[model samples]
Target: MAAPLTLLLIVAVTIRAALYRSSLVDIISERVEVVSPLTAWKRVVEGLALLDLGVSPYAGDVFHETPLIIYLFHFVIDYAEITFMLADVITAVALYMSAQEYNKQVFRKQRFALEADRYPMDCIELIRSPKEMYYIPLKVAMFYLLNPFTILSCVAKATCGLNNAVISLFILATIKGNVLLSAIFLSLATYQSIYPLTLCASALLYLMQRQYIPVNPRRASFWWFVAQYAFMYLGSLFVIVGLSFFLLGSWDFLPSVYGFMEHPVFLIFMQLAVISIFKSYPTVGDIALYMAFLPLWNHLHRFLRNIFLVSCVLLSCSALFPVLWHLWIYAGSANSNFYYAITLLFNVAQILLVSDYFYAFLRREHHLTYGLYLKRKDGSEATLVLK
Candidate 1:
């Protein structure tokens, strides 16, 4: 795994380095789908210039990144390309570790269930084998590192890579049962973009589950654990916010950075796609994070209804985005409506993809619990319908 991961990193780095030096770097950086205003390298450069001139980066409406980001680039501006590449590497590695840890937990639970004879005899076919689970983490890393969206985001130097790294670290920490580190990374992620704040509840729920704490409202232990995690998360967030203010000596960033994104409902896996579509300024980097998780749910493929159709739609949209943008902005043959129509279709496709996966996952769980062939009380075949 180490050798393969290292080779993948090398290949990923080589590709990014090549693109960074090519004529397409500028074009890639300017693409609206690849680099949004909030995460754009160009705006980061502008912010760095403002900071160098003793002016606030947020004084103008151009830069909306957090203060820590501006200062981070201030020191490493010369190696911006390397920094973005490193961020992508960190994200992939973290996700790999996370997937590995999660697989272990799942296998452990399945073993326990088997020992207890909790699953139906007819559902034996649904049991996962070690061989099938072994390559999931590696595939997860490969998916992320080799994903065209991830590659483009890295080449464009989008800070969305940094955000993904933070979120990935948060996930790794959560799965590894390090409460404090999870809270810290979660805070950092939320601080980077308000959208990640929704992950707090999911992380808390996962941590509680790992600790064998039931979610009964009457349990003092449950409440205590919740309070403890909340305090750590909020405290870490406060410290990060305070440090930002101390660095800049003002609260100007509050409105400029945190105020830019909308808050959505908490559906951990689906939230990433929602953010990518609904954020004030979205980019391909945001979509890469969610798409990387698809492999983790590969077992649900047999139950998925629209996987092929959704895949076709997503691929078509990805290719047409540039063509439509070129027509609208450069060729002047198409209008904003033309490009926006594609954007709407792209988002709808993503929503359908996420929804289909969610349904498939639920169906798999149902089958695993009740047996593959469900029957009614009268011995007639039964069907499950989602409202």
Candidate 2:
């Protein structure tokens, strides 16, 4: 594990170091498709400057990052590049360790279930063998370290890498059954970005599963467990938010950071619907989706088909983005509509990629439980219909 991880680190560092030395770093950092309002390194620097001058970093709307992040860079501004690189490395290592631990737990549960005859005889084939799970951690680490998005983010010095690292650490702590560490890391992630609050659902589910607690809402034990985790998550979030308030002496961040929560649940849903319906910048959505959870879907790739087509579509989209942007922004030969058309195509390709894998995963699960081939009542072959 150390040798392979060291090799991966060497490769990743070489790529980043070369990019840093090249003239492309500046160009990549300014691209809208690569940097956003929240994760842009430029804004972080701006905030740090204001902090150094004893001014509130949030005085201007230019800095949208959380207070914690600004303070983090205040002391380490000179080592920004190294900080971003270390964040990426930390994220990869945490994810690798978490994956290794998770596989062991899953295999142990499977063995116990088999000995207890908990699974149907026909479901035996669905059971994963130790050999297949052996290198999953290494593969996960490699996928994350070598992923193009991660590389681009690192080279550009986008602060998204830090957010990802925090979330990855949260996952690692959670999988290791350290409730306090998990809650703290999770709160740190939520402080950086509100999107990670959704991860609470998965954390709760994993904890419950680890305890062998059935998810029955009517049970007191189930409710007690939910309350316990919820309290820890919310308590930590509250403390962090209060600290931010004390640091800034202003509540301006409340609206910008968590305004989505001001409304009732139905209103929140409506707000999201409105944003989706009226959004003019699909690139933001595309990048957010791709960067966040794409690696987690690696296991579904083997079950999917049309890999060649999906690969081509994705690669073509990646290449075309800059070209289309150039034509629209500088060339002015192409209009917004032209750029948008490619954006739409890119998003559609992403949808197809995810949907195909989803379909394949469901189909594979069905085949594993029931026989791989199905027959109709009249002895004719049957086909599976998603509808």
Candidate 3:
């Protein structure tokens, strides 16, 4: 199993790496054309740097939207169009399998080895007891490794779910009760986009689990989380101040980078997401579906967290885009940022459906693993695993 898995992983990664490298050529050149119906998708993403330059001497220069890691800015940020092409493409693929493998490895190595028994008796409780003889798919997501959704999402990178892979690691860590990891990832996700908060439902899990056993509320692990977010947003606040002074005139009408919270359209969608999360609790997969679509809430700067949240609400209100486009065409309301906002919305929706599919398949694999477990057990207390 190890050798074959290793070989397959190698082959899969190689193929993906080659494709991403090729995509880089087009992305860097802006040769990656914005297809229509999805035209708003293209422009909105492209608008950020453009708006940043509106009042500056660089306004005449074309702005680029290739995403680059914050630390890579020394060489990349000034180039605009030549932004993080290679990174985004590679990160996209890495997000798919790397995330799957990372999560599964965490489970197999840290989870089952310790709490060997009481697995199917209660999947959640499996974390506490040290015994054997049951199987649980939630302990290891089956479809994540085998499923082609990651490939599909990669082939279709324009969407939010695909773009969100790296960041989703953070969201998932939060779900699994890794605080420092979650906060760190959340900070990264918050900077990447404001969309991750929709997955905030995972926070409920964290709060509950923290109190479940020996976790120390007073430990630095607990307070480390507070400081991490404090710094992330505090840094964002500083950026907002600088941006405020930078875009003094456009502050009122222009869409904010932190618009995930306050944009009219974004607000509505976020509310719907929250409601859906709570309402769908009865169905295991429904909450998963709701989460898969929640986009990242990043700070390009210039607004409050609340404001950014609202913008997400508006952009994701896909129902209003026709009117928005009409307004743009009529020179009424559309700005370059409008396109950016809407594309983020489209991406979120794409991720939701696809993620649910992956999660569902994981559930199916759980059923199969359990069937095997029932047959293999000697009815003795000892657990029999594939290994």
Candidate 4:
């Protein structure tokens, strides 16, 4: 396990180091497809320069990164390239560990279910085999490390990589049932970018299940768990925010860092729909992160309906994003509307893909609980309707 992961780390680092030394680093850093207003390395440098000159980084519109990142890079500016590469490695390693732990828990549950005959008799083929599950963790690490989106983000020194690293660590902590660690990392993520606050749902869900608590609103145990986690999460967030205020001596960052003015309600919902909904690289990295789980869900292939169509739409949007950006920014033949239209389509594709997976997972669970074949009142075969 360590050998392959070490090799993967070496490969990823080599690629990043080479790109950092090459001439493409500057070009890649400036490309809209690779960096956004909040995560661009250029903005961080500008912010650092401002901080050095005894001015607020956020005083001008050029720097929108959080105060923490600015302070972090304040000292490590010399090793900025190395720091980004290390962040990618940390994210990959954290994800690998989390995936391995999750797979073991899944197999344990499946084994218990089998022993208790909890599965439907006709659903024998849906049972996962050890042979098929053995390599999933390694594949997950590979998918994240070799993913072009992650590579680009790292090479461009996008601070999104650091956010991703924190999120990956949060996922790992949650899976390991470390409530304090999970809440801390979750708060850190939320502080970095408000979008991760929506991930509280998934994290709470995973934590509740790990503790064997039923997810019923009327149940005391469920509510207790929810309140406990919520308290920790919210408390940490408040502390972090208060610290940021004290450090900066102003609240100007609230609107800029959180995008409080523009689309406040819609921004939260939009970010919730696509957790990785950065302008470009972040979304792809999010897609790749989930893509690692597809093999674990191979049993769900038979249950999915629009897998192919959803995949094609996502692929087309990904391919078109760069072309549209080029035309709008360089060729001068297209406008922001054209580029934004593709961005909308891209996010729509992501939503549809995630929805398909949600459906497939639920349908598979249904088959496992009930019989795969459902009978109507008239003794005829019944089919599930998503709509």
Candidate 5:
């Protein structure tokens, strides 16, 4: 049922303008401008020359910071159509895999595990009747149908390199008890994009819960917790060091992470993380999505993943509108703000839209409650009167 929508998302991203040749050089130029300010002017001048080349010398310029794998797009991804479509296909696969995991947790494990004897995790769970086991599928089916945020965030990473869908899949694999594979995926994810290093969050969480592996003979949660955070902090420190070596220019700004903490958006991003955890808590999939979005934070330690993954790009775009407009008005870049505002608006729309899907899951639960109450035979119960 979800397969077709997954395909549609891939198709849409492949056609977006950002994937085309015309914009590739410019995107690289922006990065170069940020990292190598000295070369910014020279690169811009040379960048302009690409416009009229005979064989188009500039068409195949190596992206100094990007891997050859991503650079493969230069030679092959000719049309905007091909780019979006390919992105969609990649995203569709990643998203479905994520959804499969979610299904296992929410439907197979948690839903099945509960019984009248087991105290409920929340109030609704305690109060509700047996509901007949068959309804679990109906509920899960409804969630997959409505979970926009889950779909978009999964999709966005695949399309835009907004985050590493590949690495995310790897992290999910680890949480699913594939530790050796997780290690390999983790290394590859780091190599692919520096930001996925924050996947430490999920790694730590998994290790704490006894799901992560070291093949330890002793099963002490304390030692496991220590080892997990020890690795998390250690991995984080080294990943930063590695990025500093590779990105070289970012070395200059590393101090800022420890310095001023004045930005309001910083708090907002943190709040979003906190809120998301409270709302759905972290499944390995949810954690991956959160880690992916972390890089989009307005900070240096940001993850390589972002909400613009092939899935979320469109939905995020819708939310970006007011956010960027306010930024444009403040930055006073009235002349150049139009495009920037448009880009941001789209990103925001996509995120909120995706989130709406999760909230819809909760709504489905609410609807169930509402339905059961409506079917109550007692006349007073229908009037919202005390039982």
Candidate 6:
């Protein structure tokens, strides 16, 4: 696994480095789909220049990145390419470890359920085996590193890659059941982008699940855990924000950096997808984050509806994005409507894909609980329908 991951990292780095040195760097950086207003490297450079001139980076409308990020690149602005590349590597490695730990927990829970004869006998085929799960971590790592979206973002030096790295670290920490690290990383991610704040509930739920804390109002232990986790998360966020304010000697970032879209949390996948699709200035890097998790649900393929159609739609839209952009911007033959149509279609395809997976997962859980073949009281076959 290490050897394969090493080779993949080297290959990913080579591709990014080549693109960084090539003439396409400017072209790639200027792409609307690859670099948004908030995460563009050029804006970061502009902000750095302002800081050097003893002016607040947020004084202008150009730079929207958080204070900590600007400070981070303040020192590493010369090696911006390496910084982006390193962020991608860190994200891939964190996701790899997270997948491994999550798989183990899933297998453990399945073993307990099987021992207790909790699952229906007809659900035997749905059980995941170690052989099938063996390479999932490597696959996850490969998905992140080899993903074209990830590569494009890295080459563009978009701060979205850095946000992805922080979110990945939060996921890794939560899966590993480290209470403090999970809170801290979650805070860091939330600080970077306000959308990540939705992850707080999910993380707390996951930690409570791991610790066997029942979600009952009567359980003192549950409330204690919730309070403790909230305190840590809020405390860390306060500290990070304070550090940023102290570094800049102003409160300008409170609005420029932290003021953005608010999202509701349903599941982690849906939350991520919503953020990517509905954020103020979305980019391909945002989409890449959620797409990496799709492989983890491959087991639900049998229950999925519209997988093929949705996949085709997504692929076609991804390919047409640049062509449509060129037509709208450069050729002037087409208009923003033409490009926006594709963008709308692309987002609709994403929504359909997410909805299909969510349905499939629920349906699989239903089958595992009841018999695969459901029957009514009259011994007639029953069909489940969404109301």
True-vs-predicted CA distance for residue 295, candidate 6, Å: 1.5
**Lowest summed lDDT window (length 10), candidate 4:** 210-219
Local distance difference test scores for all models: 0.75, 0.63, 0.36, 0.68, 0.37, 0.76
Give lDDT tens digits, candidate 6, residues 1-387: 789888989998999998888999898898877886677899899999999999998876767788998999899988888989999999999988888888887788889999999998878999888764678888888888889999999988989999999998988898888999999998898888777776665666667761121122110122223334564755544453444334323222222332211111125666677667655456889988888877777788899889999989988988888897778678998975676678778878887988898778778877888868888999778898999
Roughly what TM-score does model 3 have, to 2 decimal places?
A: 0.34
Worst 10 residues of 6 by lDDT: 210-219
Roughly what TM-score does model 6 have, to 2 decimal places? 0.82
Runs of candidate 5 with Cα error greater than 4 angstroms are 2-64, 69-71, 74-84, 120-122, 125-159, 207-387
- TM, every model: 0.82, 0.73, 0.34, 0.77, 0.40, 0.82
Clashing pairs in 1: none
**For model 3, how does the per-residue alpha-carbon lDDT over 1-387 read when each residue is reduced to its tens digit?**
334444545554565456556754343222111111111124333444454545431233322222433124434445422222333333333333333443354446546544665235423432322222111221122233223333322332333332244454654564455777767766665454343444443343333430011111110122223334564745544453334333332322322332322222222223324332222011111122233233221111212223344445534553454445555546777753464355345435434533343344344335323532344346544465796
242-343 per-residue lDDT for model 4 (tens digits): 443343233223335433332122222233334443321243444555555555556668878888987798778778877877887789999766766776
Residue 222 lDDT, candidate 3, scale 0-100: 20
Show where candidate 2 strays beyond 4 Å. Answer: 117-125, 210-302, 375-387
The alpha-carbon lDDT assigned to residue 365 of candidate 1 equals: 70
lDDT of 1 by residue, 1-387 (tens): 889889989999999999888999988887877876677899999999988899888777777788999989889999888899999999999999988888887788889999999998887888887675678988999999999999988988889999999999998898888999999998899788876776665676667661111222110122223334564755544453444334323222222333211111114566566556555456788889988888887777889999899899989988998888788778999976676677778878887997797677667777877788978999777998899
The order of the candidates by lDDT, greatest first, is 6, 1, 4, 2, 5, 3
Which lDDT tens digits does candidate 2 get at residues 119-212? 6565566667787455777777877777777778788888878877887798888788788998999899778665555556456545555111
Relative to the true structure, candidate 5 reaches a TM of 0.40
Q: Check candidate 2 and list the clashing pairs.
A: none
- For model 2, the run of ten residues with the poorest summed lDDT: 210-219
1-387 in candidate 5: lDDT tens per residue?
A: 455554545444443433343544444333310113111223323433443354343354422223333344445544434443443345335544543453454444344445533332333432323332323333332233234343332222222232334654564565465677767777776564444454444444443441121212111122223344565745544453444344433322322442212222222223233322322111212323443333222122112233345346654544554345445446665532453445434334444533443343334445433543443466344445576
- Model 1 spans with C-alpha error above 4 angstroms: 210-267, 376-387
